[model samples]
Target chain A: MTDDATRGPDPAAMLAVAEEQQARALRLLEPDGAVIYGAWGVAWLVGPGLMWLSRAHDVLPIGVAGAVFAALLLGAGAVTAVHVGRRTQGVQGVSQQTGALHGWSWFLGFATLTAIMAATARAGASDDLLALLWTALSCLVVGVLYMAAGALWRDLVQYSIGVWILVIGAAGALAGVPTNQLLMSLAGGGVFLGAAALSRLRRRA
Target chain B: MTSGPTLNGLDPVIHAESRLRITATLAAVDRGDRLSFPRLQKLLDMTAGNLSTHLRRLEDAGYVEVTKTFEGRTPATYLALTDPGRVAFATYTAALRALLRPTDGGSA
Candidate 1:
């Protein structure tokens, strides 16, 4: 013990190192950042249901589902971009790159899914298969994005949420399309919205 | 392996504390990662004048790339590390590690 005290670095220098580490913590965003992602989740959750209802009943608004889909896409993107652009005014590297990746992956995934839906419809596949494919593809996009986000930011909660989506998607597929749609609404959208709320609460705390 | 931890290998250009911190911070991001000037200022918490001075030193070394652009009415300055800068930072880290390692024959 006596020998250690004589050889160790100065206490003041060590304190400075500790303080620097604390300041570095600010490099990470507050939980409110993730709350914006909840909007995307809500879109995923409700979009399928709206589509199903739109087809089932023609009495409702003419293009409600399609309109909602477009709205959610643009709306979520705008809101999240604004939130990130403002929140990340200073910490620009990781957050900025992650945002770009998130946007591109979602955009590409949605485009691919839309193409798949169109092709299947033209190919005369059963609606059940079409629904399953839709759910599966949607789930995959959510899962991959979540996992990528988690890996980039090193966030376990977001990563786990991705896993949850993958599992929910898989289970829904196995059970069939109707079940898958419900799960997308419940487990898929449900958990996202829930996590967003939780993030909000944590930020307040 | 000589007598003790070595400092002879450190790049003199980035040897100082503030500069080392700045380089390390920049290095943590990807090669092309551009950080807004205001953001970098906040991250380093140094006076704008002093920060600019240090940045100028690194710029002269060809280690940092700086860009100035207008975001609406405001001018935004973005900074990223050049390839040479990244290599220099990596070399600096290796040297620092070699310096901090124990001199005794125990494997670490």
Candidate 2:
């Protein structure tokens, strides 16, 4: 019988090792999904929750709630930026370009949406209409962007979350005022938190 | 009669098990990205001396690039696969697959 040394390394075994090592390297390139989703979950849950509480129970001034919401959103953005930056540090290539472009899409999309909403508000839209417009439009932007990201990465989970967010946005708009805020806080935040947990479990498995 | 596939197409530099693992790991990183020596050693679970030896061989073949720099007060070594290295690894894997295909009757 021919021994391993005489035959050289088994081609099949070598191929298996190659596949395993490549998988490990790819895993290293991904940012921590749980941390990213958890940050957004907290922001969505608490930010809109505060606003909903203020509107529904008059527990706090709407202005204060709005400020808190803005702060939380900014905080979530910061966390995402830091996490992604750390993961890609010292790496350069098409991935870096893709990430930069995706990040800009979020900023540009929101900026444009804000401009349109501001114009509506300036043109004598009622407080009720303005509130609905802001919530629905923001959700729409997030949903579309998430789907785009999912398509780019070919991640089913991300794409599913995007679809779910769109449903929440639509339902919240139909539900109307104060209640819409509550719906978004609970439904939108719940999905983010759930996604975070799922991501963690997936990694472990 | 059809002849069986041969392993002649495999790049000798990347055919060794240790070197194959190293090359595969580096190829997975995005082009122009560098992996630190300590990180690679930990990932591969190899001793410092052993990894250095394989790395030197790869470097000699122009399939790997090693850079030394100071991070803060400490010296650090980083490794990357050159363009030629990436091409070689790709060709090697393709050849490996082709060799296995006939033995497995193309089931893959």
Candidate 3:
């Protein structure tokens, strides 16, 4: 045990009424944690994965199948997020702060992604280069956000997911846009769904 | 000479565990909507009678406001932190910080 835990009860008990009460609120919060993360992940990553599969529709348009798959996965992800985020507990005080921070951080990432995409499109960048840049940068954003979320909540799993996304994103950049999208969709979606499932299981238990 | 920290600013009303949890929980919602009674009951692990009793105390102190609404004929009670309650919680925390801080830590 650390020094504080080992120490006998001191007169200066930190559990002053207000402090103790705040701690209770924090504990009850458990934070909005990974539900949102998983939801976005499944939606963003898995939808694209299906798109890649549909590109095999030689009988149809070149990417018709892929487009259909992406749309469906994206739809599913959105629905899942709404369903999961509907928590019985009103947001806890600590959670309120963190959720706001995390939500904004991701929003910033999306904004950045949009800016980069728009700039590249205006520049008339080649399709391949544009795709590569988008995938790489997107990966970095996802990774960093997950890391931030993990750090804020002191959850290693969340942090690891962030790290994993970074790796996938980085690796995809080198492998070209198609490969990058595929890897991100498969690995990223898996991670999101896995985390979501774990969260659900914990809540059930 | 400086006196040590005291509980003068501590809100005895909000200090109790259940009420504290309730207040903090209500305060946490960013949208400023009332928390349903069943939600509080589950979150705080309080029995219906116990939850209502503590809520009554907070209501009496003007720290919380409770309203009853019907969701398709099933009556529902929602609890929200009043303006005074928020102010009280803030004042309580400021006092708490002062008490927790070192009296002579300004070792410049």
Candidate 4:
């Protein structure tokens, strides 16, 4: 093989190419932020919005509202799975493993938390108390998970969303029942939608 | 006086412009992660023939691994940097930095 002395390309030009290619690679690796954030935003808004509407007005039955909320959450989960899977398709290695493990963590975390909450309800927790507990704890889990993801990826937008969710969750708990639902539907959902827009703008920039 | 190996230390295998760009792109991926041939070509904006030629050179030097497989009914080609490739690229960058470093300790 020839040495660098025999090669004619300037070192500075090569360095520039390296930097440019690296940036391109990273961009290709990043999942579509707008889709992810938007899916959650829609779910957060409509799900809790329905719940609050049922509570405030006698429009839909609470049972139906609850069912819709659960369904929306499931839909959001499915979207996240599909989006991530498609993006990483044909790629293998530590990144794929990391994504798989992280996805399982969310599933396991919610399943365990739900089981514990259900147990509390069975043990004579009042319906109102159960509702507040579920809301607070659910938000707490999402907040913590988002923050953990942000830290792992070093994404400021995700970290900020986590902080906002935690704050909203706390405020909603203190506000109580119907008000809490409204707060979550408005404040919680609002932040998610706002973040989605911001993410899109940042991508464009 | 100069202390160690200078610009002469740069790996000729990776020193070429196209090969350097290819190596840099592959290096950005997570260890062991691979990029599809079409994807890498698009990223580099190189013609398939051009990319294949450079890739062969890198593969020859044991710096790259190219895998051919079937994705459903379609043929697919994926490429990744071998461990030795990573080391070579790292060493190349270090030597490049050394060469670029101002001899009087000024900013490069």
Candidate 5:
């Protein structure tokens, strides 16, 4: 065998080809930015709704109820997000890892919004007109929330319809309306029931 | 024809063992959310340095990305799979599935 010094030098072209392969291999994976995006959206929807509830209860002595409700709902959201993150810790794929985050964001956002509106109503806002207006807006916004979540999860359920009722009820309440609870009830109740419907469908399938 | 190892989309040597484990772990949790470093290390049953080295390799490959932020005074490490990593893992799984499927002759 020839000595190391006598061996022909490694081909320059071969080294270039190997380097190119390494670079190409490294180019394939990009971190899933969607996870962060979903988390931010969830935070935004809940945070604003919580703050609004605190403001709506201006008549209340210390806004204790509103603040408590905000803490609970937001706390729940944060817990859920952390739980999901832990669960998917080493998982691959954007779609698979984001499933829980998407679900958590949708439900928490809706619940927080609903609770805020309810707190506003109970705060002794004597102006039925303003109460109605705020409630209607909450319904519409909740509907949009449901719609967003539904699209992500890909199943149409009663929860989506509930959003519509919340919107309509708020409108009626604003227009000197009386006894328009059905809309609000449907929207609020729809969330739990909608989740159930999806579960049932999955089981049957 | 005998099928062999491939990289990305091209035939190449199989990935290192540590990297392979990281990929499998991530793939299993794809339907969930992010994973913390401590949890990942525990699940992989690896030393902190070992797992960190493996993670660095995967991150260099662009299959995973790490986010470091402070939770109060403590630092937190969160990991998530990138879109390309997901696709690569899926393809790898499909190939494995195909290989594992029973053939017409009743031997895999």
Candidate 6:
């Protein structure tokens, strides 16, 4: 045993060092994070937003328009996924593995969206509990898939946000919340932009 | 001119093509920013030796730091910007912006 007078490593200093390292890691992680979310914002969320507007304008048959929108959305998601995957391919050992996971999840998400649109179309605006449950489950499935992918990417905040999308979708379906889309826009798109702003500020400071 | 900051306080010599692109790429990242050598190579399309020379200059200037560790028996090189480097880049950018478009009271 050491004497009481002897000095040991300072816990506070250790914590500070860890914090600094974390900050550094965050700095390094920023680029990939921005690209991922930026692509997600433009491709995934924007497609839905555009479809909503088109439907509002009665530009085409609702079902037909939704199908076209789903195709477009899927196309966009595929492009981004493929790009990220191509960029990070063949990197042996690094967090770059997250890129592959993200790409696959994006493709999976696109497939899920297609399914949701099909199911909803078949249900024909019904207020049935079964329809709501199925939709909610679909949302949950997609959200969990995205969460897993984001976790692999080491984007914890984004992963949590993605998982929460399921919660919001399910809650909206169950509670018959009409503003579900708006809420998601705020949660998914708004939160992402906010996080980006905060990150930029931190870097500048 | 008017004593404003540059983007990264990077000297013009440092701000040459490759380094400038690298700094801009790094600056645009959110958080947890790391660039692998291969990624950097792809991004800039520079030969390994050319990239290494520029990286060395950057490291010597205290702008970037490199880490080399084994990745399952294969070695990987990671590049990160130091805090000072970030500040300098941001300052340099601000200066460039000020020069390019001076802020006025919404002047037409």
On TM-score, the candidate that comes out on top is 4
Candidate 1: stretches off by over 4 Å: A1-33, A49-63, A87-103, A125-129, A148-154, A197-205, B1-34, B42-47, B53-108
Instruction: Report RMSD (Å) for each prediction in the order shown.
Output: 7.8, 5.7, 9.8, 4.9, 13.3, 14.9
- Clash list (residue pairs), candidate 3: A51-A66, A54-A66
lDDT of each residue in A3-90, candidate 1, tens digit only: 1212334324433443453346344433254557588777867775676555555434526775887688678778887776765665
What is each candidate's fraction of native interface contacts (fnat)?
A: 0.19, 0.42, 0.13, 0.56, 0.08, 0.00
Worst 10 residues of 4 chain B by lDDT: B1-10
Per-residue CA lDDT of model 4 for B1-108, tens digit only, reads 112333476777887788888899899888868888987887778889888988888898889999898989999999999999999899888777777777895653
lDDT (10s digit) by residue, model 2, range A1-205: 1122224588899899899988886677678789899999999999889989998999999999999999999999999999988766656556777788988999999999999998999999998898888889988999998898899789988898898889888998999887778888899888999999998998887
What is the per-candidate TM-score for chain B? 0.84, 0.86, 0.84, 0.88, 0.73, 0.75
- Candidate 6 regions exceeding 4 Å error are A1-31, A43-47, A50-60, A64-68, A82-90, A93-135, A149-154, A177-179, A195-205, B1-108
What TM-score does chain A of model 2 get?
A: 0.88
* Overall lDDT per candidate, in order of appearance: 0.69, 0.84, 0.67, 0.83, 0.51, 0.56
Best by DockQ: 4
Give every collision pair in model 5: A30-B82, A89-B35, A90-B26, A91-B26, A92-B26, A96-B30, A97-B30, A132-A173, A132-A174, A136-A170
Each candidate structure's TM-score, on Cα atoms with residue i matched to residue i, is 0.59, 0.75, 0.56, 0.77, 0.45, 0.45
Candidate 5 per-residue lDDT, tens place, A161-204, comes to: 54555555555465433333333334343444445455445434
Candidate 4 lDDT score at position B23: 94
Q: In candidate 5, which residue ranges exceed 4 Å CA deviation?
A: A1-126, A152-178, A193-205, B1-21, B27-36, B42-50, B53-84, B105-108
Better of 1 and 4 by TM-score: 4
Clashing pairs in 2: none
Candidate 3 CAPRI assessment class:
incorrect
Per-residue lDDT tens digits of candidate 6, residues B1-108? 123232234354233555555565544443345677887666555688877877776677677868787779999897777776677666655544444454577466
All candidates: TM-score of chain A: 0.71, 0.88, 0.68, 0.86, 0.40, 0.55
Q: Sorted on lDDT, highest at the top, how do the candidates line up?
A: 2, 4, 1, 3, 6, 5
